[model samples]
Target: MPSLSEVISCLSDYDPNALPVAQAQQIIRDVVTPVEAVEKVALRSALDRVLAHDIISPINVPQHDNSAMDGFAVRGADVGPDKAATLRIIATIHAGGGFDGEVQAGECVRIMTGAPMPQGCDTVVPQEFTQAAGEGEVTIPAGAVKTGDNRRLQGEDLKAGKPALAAGKILRPADLGLLASLGIAEVPVRRRLRVAFFSTGDELRSIGEPLDPGCVYDSNRYTLYGMLSRLGCEIIDMGVVKDDPATLSQAFRIACESADAVITSGGVSVGEADYTKQMMAELGDVTFWKIGMRPGRPMAFGKISSNGRNACLFGLPGNPVAVMVTFYFFARDALLRMMGAEENRLPLMRVASESPIRKKPGRTEYQRGIVATGADGVQRVRITGSQGSGILRSMSEANCIVVLHHDQDTVHAGDMVDVILFEGLV
Candidate 1:
């Protein structure tokens, strides 16, 4: 019998031969986490990247109270219901210009949208409501408009020294526009997570090469590279490597030395040519492997400290769909945690199923699905004909993934399932 300490080590150790998906996700979150560091990046290059620090507003948006309409800035007290109050449009104010004179009780200032409201003017009537008959005079309608109806108050959008953007938020297009409104020319963001990827197997070939009878072209790395780049990660596609320990050891060393994280496809299962797992074990400690799932059950994780830098590693399944799913479930979260992302889970949406679907009760499944609105304006989803891990075309056309968790034993035609939106991914 082994000693108690040896038994504890045995139980705690991550076995690439028998790790589950949840276990894998947890291990990744624990082993490789984020530490805040700043990188000065252009606004154009900061999309989808996590903010390393909070952004404060330097100037009050709209610096002063202004008109939201292009009619006239008037003293509302002087205008009566259904009464015509004639006033001299003392001055015209276009965008980027303002009225100079103060408005008397019955006077008005002709103003355009975004123009500063004249002094003593509190409301704006749209040009459509006022009839302009002369060079500088207009009639105010007797049907009195509400005060402040067409005015954008000073500092309404943002106040100086206010938190414009909270740290850890992922930047989107709207965020960029908001930052621009705050007059921010540059942002301090987390430097892109340097990611490296490759595929393995003696039975893999590059797309340009003639296909061998028993081999298939490698596509996982390309897909991984593209998706990671879209997520604002700097990717290094190391290409394909054969299923040999020596070559893998050298390649792994390079990836560990250079990238913040390394990803590979295939050669991680317990088979004769499964050299990646063993090679990784030799180079560094593999966190876990072997998630309980369909199609792509074999996965691997580890940390490698070599050369100049240390990196986290992931080994996805060989099949195309498996590789994509594994990345979403595993590496995506890992990258998020490493990037100081506020959201731990990816964005998900709920949709009702239009037709009955079959599923087993062992593990979770992500089926490619198309989402459309029914007559009631409710989103209904229908799964593609095949959800096989190799069905790349179906995955391409899908807009969502219908999630089937382990505890969900059955689903009916109208049953609701939580579908992860893949609109941007596709």
Candidate 2:
């Protein structure tokens, strides 16, 4: 792997201070490399796991031509376009059963959904489109179906010896079903990433500890735990490390030795106690950035080493909401890359704003929003009650985040604004 300096040298317009959000993301992408470890797991156990190798279909899906609907299978030539056609139902074919009997020109087969199509049949006219003419006869109305309609051709879903799933794909429920259809009992996937995180501050206390006069219980670690767990990472919670330089340095070393990444909330900003930045500089190549973004501005990102073992470090802001925002926008993608996941950015959908929003140019803003369908049936977004970085309730009440672009100014009521939903109706 190339050093962070070498990587940054390649980019002509690299600025640590006042870094653009896109530039910060691109820098992270260029620096991080995927972990190279593979394991074989059962199909059911591979959900959310990143695939290590391309999965080629061993056999065609639906080995034979099957019926897509519960209907009558007949020759397309027998069904005229302008006139109704009547045919005798010679046999019935149920799902998982084979119909070997041939259908003549004036004969049809009563086929259930997923049943193999008869030897000479090409199309299926759904049962609803046909009326029973007699005990063994049915009539298909004109313009009911056309040639090559409602027939699921053999290997239509996955052909034999073809790639079905590519490497780096994070398997979902549908992917598991696809594997089951191909009779894949096990799949090879990348090993889960191990992440170690802690909160640093003299005024921070852990749960169950008595609160001091000005100390507050640390919530960053718990939130980080939840976010990291949802991303399929094995988390090593280091608890709350004090603001002392010696103690913090030891924690960083231990974290680097045990995990692939280390995340710390607080102490990255230009405060009187610059021990975190000083210790980071002594240990590895890290950069402190004042990014051009709201809620999250002070951040530290780079690779750090301890006892010859190195791990990526993401030092986030001290504020609770700022930590969450920075993690979602910056650290999440880098961690996904390290875990060997090939995923695109979450899509931003445009929806009307329920009220005017106060925004300024030059810095991107991510406001917590409640998106819902109004009485008029149009989906609109309203900002949460308090948009403060310390107000954790804002994040809890929000179902989506309204993203205002860096170059965009204030937004008027009813204007289309881009939003990324947190809870989708899947």
Candidate 3:
């Protein structure tokens, strides 16, 4: 008999500060999980990892101003429409060497891209623009010669002691080059978050097992495993546990002990055989159940005491697509919270609708849809087929979920709906 708001309120009251998704994020903003001190790891091992602490540049990127192009480093007074200056191409400054001699007026240095700028040289005319007419003589183009034309300013990438990356920031491929620019051979990164999930249903059987008259092959666990892997969680799958309370409790214990969070499919709804809810409450005060959302009416969240730590537990609905969607919207945020990720919500874009869709008030709906481009250069979306939770293929072929808020009852063509594109559809 608990309303959605009431359940959220109760959960807020249950924990000291952890509110539901709406407010929980705010409450946990400053509350970062324990960062396991900085561990210096080789740069090769730092890719696709989160920074454990802020990293400041020990040296200026590029070390010093250098030539941005292979050209003649010269003074602005050296080139003009009056006539070509007979400048001696003394020593070629090829990247590593510093031009020792001062570049006098009407003199230039042959420099390559990434070569350090000589002490007195300020401008560079590209080699193409300059023609070598004779020995120790090059043609300077008669054009608007601006001062500091091709100077690669020192600290252009980053200044010494500048914050190159902040703590808790997720690193990308390009970040490696930045780290290298800072001369960081090793990086301090946070430990990976551990997540364990399992599937539970009496009518479920493994793929290899013979299907019974009323049973179906278990797909929730495999799907969840793949999804969690993509989310960067260390997974420990407990396989398929039956509907029995003892078996479910044991499996939950295993997950709670070894994982940062425990996720289980099935046995979360208001069914007579449903035991996950009760077992969660018995194990370690499960805060609430039954969110006000379509395809995820039976979601439970809370903690389960196992070993020394209280691992977070999420009881997802049994439907394969429901499990996936609910996890993406609801549990994924929480798991990211545990991982100390700065951003919780995925990027959602507003896309116009090509067709209308049915809906009812009181629950938010995530209808699968195909997103296509319109002549107006905006993404237009339409529901692929049935908005049923069991339709997994519908979600597969679709590119995004056109999110319908709980307040909206119907959507018309050309109406704008918040669309969340599949993370890896490309």
Q: What lDDT score belongs to each candidate, Candidate 1 first?
A: 0.80, 0.91, 0.76
Predicted candidate 2 versus true structure: per-residue lDDT over 258-346, tens digit per residue: 99999999988777337667888898999899899988889999999989898999999999999999999999989999999996466
lDDT, candidate 2, equals 0.91
Please identify which of the two predictions, 2 or 3, would achieve the higher TM-score against the true structure: 2
Residue by residue across 132-225, what tens digits does model 3's lDDT show?
8689877785773567888899888889888999887777778888888777898887777888888888899998999989999998888888
Which stretches of model 1 miss by more than 4 angstroms? Answer: 1-20, 35-37, 80-84, 132-136, 272-275, 374-378
Between candidates 2 and 3, which one is better according to lDDT? 2
Q: What's the lDDT of the predicted structure labeled candidate 3?
A: 0.76
Report the candidate with higher TM-score, 1 versus 3. Answer: 1
Cα-lDDT of candidate 1: 0.80
Output candidate 3 Cα RMSD: 4.2
- Model 3 TM-score, all chains together: 0.89
